[model samples]
Target: MAEITAAAVKELRERSGAGMMDCKKALAENGGDTEAAMDWLRTKGLAAAAKKSSRTAAEGLVGVAVAGTKGVAVEVNSQTDFVAKNEIFQSFVRDVTALAMDVNDIDALKGATMPQGGSVEDVLTANIATIGENQVLRRMKRIEVAQGAVIPYVHNAAAPGMGKIGVLVALESDAGVDVLEPLGKQLAQHVAAAFPLALDETGLDQDILERERAIATEKAAESGKPADIIAKMVEGSVKKFAKENALLSQPIVHDGKTPVADVVAKAAKDAGASIKLVDYVRFQLGEGIEKEESDFAAEVAAAAGISKG
Candidate 1:
């Protein structure tokens, strides 16, 4: 058996960002070979990441890219915000946004050619190897307007547009690009900050409405009012919920008084064009993931190699 020295373990630890004991174990398992130890660490990271796949990854980057009338928004997740700051990771996000403009589907984006001399999958694999961590291209959406423009907004950071959230809005009109593009971009930024649930009330999720109605009905029943009055209360509550949740029904973020739909209309009037907000896409990282609660006592006990007292 080859001897595993402290120096060898430390070197491997620096390369992998893994614990010292983990590096030592990898070196010991791989006959004290640095190259083999590196591979071992990478395999461990991949396994650890797989375990974390079901965990909420709310801290990641929302990236956007635009070319003329076409724009794309993508959300890429990482286990930690620190990884989001890595230059290679940021570059991967930038390229993924550009790829999104060309491919409408996630699978297509995965199979698309990567500029650094391989397919997207190949590049991802190489990045995992180089970064000593596992990464994924989570989801993407693309929008384009043949007549007007698809403007993009990324809030928080820029590796050419990687941030905490991203938005894309498509404006369809006969207006010239100079007049329409600026307005479209401003609206996109507004959408990012506002985080609207739907483009309009029509698109609001029925499940949410049902849930809201149930809550409202329970609250109204407690009032001991007549059945007709209770029904009216529930209906009124639902309307209020829908207006608050829906994108267009919500008051404009910019003015804090006008609805977003009205804001767009006013912009169209100023530009002297009949503009319509056909569609919009917003991606925020880690919105739905149920973050597992950590048991601090158990963790401390394990670290100390002692049974819980």
Candidate 2:
């Protein structure tokens, strides 16, 4: 057998755009012949998959799975919406979500033994080959309940029980799981729709608070009001902003007449048990990716051999 060195792997990776380990393995399996290694990668469809990796995969699904007292949410992205609707892709995402429920740490989840047959990485590689598109297992979060249950909600439709947005809510209490699960799911749906910035006032990001304060200060200064009055106005606006954008401080969606904190209190009273809203996780598909905007008219004219008007 020929020697498979780091230099050989690097050369193959630069040619194929495959991951380092994958390139090394390809070279080793092909007897350290660069041409054979490239052929091997192309034969496995890995090179084609790697070529598409740089494409923006902002369109995909948010998957959720709840197992007993624990729940997990996952986002798997693809280059096109059509691929997002693929049954195989949806199944892969569902299985990955369940894996997330079993493993709390993200790195551990990535390396966790896949439910199918091999390691998680191996499964991803196989999916890339089978799916004919670049795919990513982007994020996962686990929610657990000490006493009650963790509930899930998904918006839109990418799968049977998954969608574009997924939320997980953990309710900790001694109440019957049968009673709390429905209410928890409703709250999770609310969170997905409302897009709350924080769980409550206390959980609001400090930088967001500062930005609001600055905006309020600028607006108040323009009024030429007295210093004390300006200060009071800024404080009032800040308080209102915090309340409106935070989950627990906002009105409950089910009733729309009471704040979420108060709704939790009422739930506890009605359930004949003390239920605490411990924590929650919400994942919106493509929340932060910068989408590219194409100039459609210009492209059309160019294709038709016409000069710009």
* Candidate 1 clashes between residue pairs 3 or more apart in a chain or in different chains: 58-286
Model 1 spans > 4 angstroms off: 1-57, 293-300
Instruction: Write down the lDDT of every candidate, Cα atoms only.
Output: 0.76, 0.79
Q: Write the per-residue lDDT of candidate 2 for residues 165-194, one digit (tens) a residue.
A: 888898998898777888897788788766
Give the winner by TM-score. 1
Local accuracy of candidate 1 as per-residue lDDT tens digits, 77-196: 766778888998888888877887888798999999977768887888888898877677888888888878888777766556778777888888888888777877778777776667
All candidates' TM-scores?
0.77, 0.76
Model 1 vs truth, CA RMSD:
15.0
Which portions of model 2 miss their true places by more than 4 Å?
Answer: 1-57, 295-309
